[model samples]
Target: MGLQNTKAPRAKRANIVMLGLDFAGKSTLLYQLRCKDVFLTVPTIGFNVDMIEMERDFTLTFWDVGGQEKMRQVWSNFLEDADGLLYVVDSSDKRRLEEARKEFELILKNESIKNVPVVVLANKQDLPGALNAEEITRRFKMKKYCSDRTWYVQPCCGITGEGLRVALERVATFARQYSRSKETFRNLKEMDTL
Candidate 1:
């Protein structure tokens, strides 16, 4: 029998988890998306949840988790059924870049998070000596880590919310891509059953 293919439908909702080293502005990014203004933020101790209508057809649930060394132990616990990852980096912190890289490796190695898209926020772009998106991508070997899924590195200033929408758009686009694949798989199964 011949197989017929059709366009898969997009999902109306998505759940994306925000992750990064401490002071990389994960919480600030969430606040900016929610209120359009950066409120003074303390270090996120556990997690923060915020929902946003990134576009008329797409809604997002962002899970911002604490990035401290101890807290990372619990990261995988929250990773069940995650749709994607939003990785924020303090682009100006040259000293801790290695630590950040190691932490990212740890996250990516978790079996629960395979094949999902990633949106990297090269944050603190407003600060002098901040690493640009290209540099951060290269330094972190992002292309290799993200080889199996769609990824985008967006330069941003979390305090001012610059490039936030662009990052969200990338996440939405990737989520749409993911939804299409899932739908296609389900359709294929149904056709086989028929």
Candidate 2:
């Protein structure tokens, strides 16, 4: 005898993919969003996934891309379908600043990912020698990108969860706006066909 289906269908959810360099505390930030303590974290070999329930209406799928030189080759595949981007940087690591700038430019140049809303997490603000939000903005020359879309250089302590909620909220808001604009464009195209 066949069994009867009784389970109710679930609501559709949205995904917000975040990509950033290695050791940028992406994983730590994800852990903090889940309200977890971070004693030790192993380097993410390929990519890490975290699901955060924002509300009854949405869910965020955070993809933390590995930052090592060898691992960066696979990041483009993930970037293609992302609705939003979060570029995380280690504010206290001065040596990687140039590398971060190069990567930022690369992302900006990519046609597929260029227009996506981005939130730059200037992480490790609790550490010594960490750059403040203004210094980060100045050094990275991020102000130019701000005009094209919603961009924020948030000073964050990933391990402690400080400023993480604000970062996520910004991403969520941007994602919503992007979705609406895309839908509007689609409708306009359909109307033109009539």
Candidate 3:
């Protein structure tokens, strides 16, 4: 019986929630991460989940929450325990600039996600009217909310994976750091009794 029980069970996964407005290229980005070509693009009716296994025995489970107006109400449930967030924006859509700002503020103000680290993907950089990273930073008013944690505002063309690597790398690093900090705090608390 002891010899038969040598194999260990799989480790639990880490959760990462990514949110964005409709047409923000969230699904396209996910496909790019998976190294696949776009065949047919469709709006997500609800949230989608994708799991990625990283080096060092870490698995990242991504919750891609839909951004439709009607679906916004259900987003908080998924954001509640998110270890990190990725906010995707359509850099070429100038008309929605104000709306994007409002959405950004809403995410930051939500009690359930206030402290989560964020990585903003300024997507559509390959388009004609695409805004640069600095422009996105100014329009979103990110400085006000970026002080407490590590935040990355990167310009990306999700269809071609132009800046996707940088954004994903940042997310992984922040998530690992957050995990380490939690473990350290737990160890310190345990040592206090000794």
lDDT of each: 0.88, 0.79, 0.82
lDDT of 1 by residue, 1-194 (tens): 89877767764887889999989999999999889997999999999999888777778889999999888889998777678899899999999998998888788888888887888899999999999999999998988887877888999998888899888788888877876776798999999999
- Clash number for every model? 0, 1, 0
Top candidate by lDDT: 1
- lDDT of each residue in 1-194, candidate 2, tens digit only: 99988977664344565556778887788788776576467778888788778777677788887888887777677878677888888999999888987887777667777667888999999999999999989988887755677777888998887888898889888877776777799999999999
Off by over 4 Å in 1: 1-11, 189-194
Look at candidate 2 and give me any clashing residue pairs.
22-67
> How many clashing residue pairs, candidate 2?
1
Error of 3 at 101 (Å): 1.6
The per-residue C-alpha lDDT of model 3 at residue 117 equals: 85
lDDT of 3 by residue, 60-152 (tens): 789988888877778788887777888999999998867877887888888877667888999999999899999999888788877777788
